[model samples]
Target: MTDASALRTAILTSVPADPFQTTAPEPRFVYVPRTHVRALDPDNMLVVGARGTGKSFWWQALLSDAARATLQIPSMSRGKLQVGAGWSENTEPDKDTLAGLRRAGADPRQIWRAVLLAQFDSGVDSMDSWKDRVDWVANHPEAVAKLIRSYDDAADADDTRHLLLFDALDRTADEWTERRALLKGLLQLVLDLRSTKAIRAKVFVRPDMIQDPEVLAFVDSSKVVGSRIELTWPRHELYGLLWQYMGNAFQGAATFRRRHSGWKKDETGLFRMPDTLRTNEQVQRDVFAEIAGKAMGTNERRGLPFTWIPTHLADASSIVTPRSFLAALRTAADETNHDSELALDWRSIHSGVRRASEIRVIELGEDFPWTKPAMAALEGLNVPCSRKDLVSRWTANSVMERLDGLPTGDRNKNATLGQQGLLNDLVEVGVLEVRSDGRYNIPDVYRVGFGLKRRGGVRPVT
Candidate 1:
């Protein structure tokens, strides 16, 4: 086929099939954003991000030497750190055991300490049940502290460190109260461990969880929150990530890399984006223009494709997650005509945004079940409307009642705040926006997926 056809085929294959399904991302796919270096530091215990961000990806990445090496963090480069999952999306401790321990009056702090200790000490791990382990930890506080200190000392002597990672803490408990208590306990444990020289804990938490007052109620909690780093993918970094994938693709690596002279491979043989490409928008735009063309259309009025792709995909908060960004391009590649001169057609890019929106809605539902019904209540309602109209739509559809009637665990705690509260909740999560004029507006990313309309915005795909 022609060069453009071959390039489009390469892009379709290069981009991940599902960026959010990153339980075990391949090593070559680990493209670290420059801004995220702080989050990789062992010192930063709390790393926060919204859904579809790289929390789970980084959690899995850090465990693999190949992935960690790509991060180039001094602490992790030596391979001297022993890393273990204290809790993860897939590797959580038994829920029934935790429930039994909580019911028996075991402090959440003690429960988590037992969990951490079990990762190192065979004696702690040998306990047949969580009850026995937690009970042992509670009764032997001094002994537990002493054992942890011994591990710390050993790590220090070896010039290494031990890291315990926690992710998906939302699944730790069904009830909001129980989940908060468990999280508070884990945060408390994180604080206590910070004093150790060679042991550290990294928690990849959702923004809502970390910001909750009840969860951060412990002493010196601000220290953790104050030092927390957000996992974000800025515009340049998003484009940089795309190039990383294209530059590393098995088929079009040479052709794609030739478009940007700054791209180079690291010691691990993976392509590394230059510092300029990572920070310079013009440089990024120039490189991207080679594949997608200069403008989204025959003229510039339709907007530059470099900016248009992300603008349409951004949430109300103006945050464009890497998952959505990549998803859009992948769909764009798939929809582009094979006979087209450009690798990606501008019209197909719009289709990409639609697909990305659908994907975002699905992800939101997985994290917050209430979102689907709440948005369903507003379907077909034109946005940039007054708050009264928004509330009326919800009331008419009995949205609040529907959300409250959801199963005990599925109910969003925010739903208890009534209609206005639900609006605030949506605004907080970047699904809805309250404009300066007090009108409610939904960002295009969510607007299309939820079947809402805007007077002059991109139409939702049928």
Candidate 2:
């Protein structure tokens, strides 16, 4: 086979089938972005990001010693930290039981304390139900405090730190008010633990959750909010991640490693990104051109593949997530013709964008169920349109009425939003954009998925 075909095979096999499937990412798959090093610090209590970013991925990654070593964070590289999930997508029993405890009039703060106490003291774990544990914790604050102190004392002696990670807080309750209250209690618990030297709580939260005024309304709330780090994947970092995966693949590892002097294998035999690849755009573009050609097509007007791929895949806020970027390239590799000179064909890259959009829309529905139906109301409607025109479409389709019927936690808020409020909600999530001329536009990543039309947009695959 030719070099292009061999490279295409390498990419298709190396890229993961599901980039968002972070329940147990292998150590080889962990690519650390330079900007995310601060986010991995145990001192940062809150880490926020939009869906498809690496919030859950990092949550799971931190739990693995191999993955933690790949991160190379000074505090975590030693592997001396004790990490446990206080709450996460996988901790369903804890969520359901905590919801029950809340209904039983148990204080959310006490409930969370019980969660921590159970981790350190087996007796707390012996309790059969959440209520029983919460009751025990509430009735015995001194005992709970003593247990935490003893644990911290041990960690201090060992020169180690204990971390409790919280993710998927939105799944804690069905009602927004209840979820907000529960989150507030968790944040307060994080603050309460701040005084302890060896015990810390890190919360991986959605941006919208922490941004709500009601959620952070507490004494010293800024202490948590002020130190929060956003999990973002800049353009160069996205390309860096791509190279990491490609460079580590068994079939093309030698070829890819030789192409760039900066790429190196670590002690674990996984590829580590160089500073130049992470920060230098021209270097990344040069490396990308080797596989996909100098430009997207024969001329510059068609756009450079290095820039076009990310530009089209970006959300309204101009954020291109690692998940979407990887997914698009993987699909492009799969669709590229075997006889083609490029590893990823320009036409296949466009196909990759469509696949990425479909995946993004599905993820949006999973995170915010109301988005699909709400966006569906504007199907076939051309973007860069006036707010009045957009509202007319929603009004004609009874979009508000349809949204009210959904079982989302934000149903009440969405129903009360009316047409104007709904538009703002979409804009806030990076699904829709408002132009400087007061027109509404949907980014290609979402526009194609929602079946919306644009005068010169990438068309959706029929």
Candidate 3:
């Protein structure tokens, strides 16, 4: 028992306390300034941004916070269901809850059908349910009528603000058609449900995933795209997070000192952290400079300071998501933890970026099997390929055909689907960028990995 107690203490001692722990009981660092405070308002909002930008954290946080407040929007639970992440409609509590509600006069089938339509359609369906739902919602006047009636009944019961937090609609790993169907269904449902002053649903989504031509046609596109709070960890914020993370990691150490130490004595004797942990300016300088350095290589001169780091080297217009940030940080931390000197070294961080780059390449390579071929072709030409030329020559080709024809003998039928999946996966993962002109390009940091030139253009690579 004594030994067990000692072990537990040691384990607890190693655990780091978070510095940016949300003051409002429920906190999500992603979407910090925007969603944290404003989300609780009665107005229904569409929190749009890039994936990993802290949408889920904020959405869940707000929901949890709402639980503690005066607001009452029916006692419905927030369900975490993303396609491929879980069986959306098959879960027991959800299915049972909806069934129970339906038995109690709620249109469980209709409400659920709308929820599924709003969340899951992504174009690649060979399934009848997908088509049926799309057609039912789009073609039938009855479907909309039924939804409005359901909303009206709920409103009559004083259950007006039915906040459905569609957190991960963009996280679905579905085909384009299914993706399109889901997006279109969401807009249709939104328009139909808006008639009821009582029913309001907030969709937290990634902008890139919603760019389907079909969905865009009906959507106020600008409402989502324009007001989207791009999840970016600017220098100051990123630095603060890093500092807080490290301070927590080193908490309880003899060298650990809080800012308020000796504050009661002398004003000049304020206890700031040691230099080993990053300051606000140092983190910004280091992150940007490191990103820039990776692209510049040994030359060490040229490129935007923001572009210098691998994390932001993809597109200035592109926003970094929380998942990507976590990936980069975990890699950097693993490397930092292993080094004899426990410090956040830029070289170690860059090495972490390279590791992330490799994973990014492999992920993109799988979906758009043409990814590797395109890179190889770029390497052969030693010049940037035009967007038109790339799509026709590579993106249009099947993964098997692309790999079977490669000169490197890296072709594998077993891995062909994996390769094709990579392209779509990378785009979903935000490693590759699809340009407005329909061209695909890799980040400049990744260009070095692929042995290609550093040129700025929107393009795809996984």
lDDT of 2 by residue, 67-153 (tens): 776776786755378888888867734667777888789887888898888787649888887778889999998888888888888
Report the Cα lDDT for residue 131, model 3. 35
Expressed as tens digits, the lDDT of each residue in 57-101 for candidate 1 is: 889898877777777777566538878888865664666667778
Residue runs of model 2 more than 4 Å from their true location after superposition = 412-417
Clashing pairs in 1: none
In order, the Cα lDDT scores of the candidates are 0.83, 0.83, 0.42
- What is the C-alpha lDDT profile of model 3 across 1-462, one tens digit per residue? 232222222222332233122233321121233223444333444555553455655554555643223222233223221121111222222434433433444332344344433433323133354334434544555655665566457554764444555555532323444444555555555555555665555666666455546666655655544433444555444444433333333233222223213212123222223333333465456533432232333344533333344344343245443344434444544454332232333444555455545554554454344457645554422224455554454545554466667543233323445545545544554545676766565564355456554443212233
The CA lDDT at 229 in model 2 is 95
Q: What lDDT score is found at residue 410 in candidate 2? A: 53
Q: What is the lDDT of residue 122 in candidate 3?
A: 26
**Candidate 3 runs further than 4 Å off:** 1-31, 34-44, 56-160, 170-174, 219-232, 247-313, 316-318, 337-342, 362-373, 376-442, 448-462
Name the 10 consecutive residues with the lowest summed lDDT in model 1.
88-97
TM-score of candidate 3 relative to the true fold? 0.53
Ranking by TM-score: 2, 1, 3
lDDT score at residue 371, model 1, on the 0-100 scale:
88
Ranking of all predicted structures according to lDDT, beginning with the best and ending with the worst: 1, 2, 3
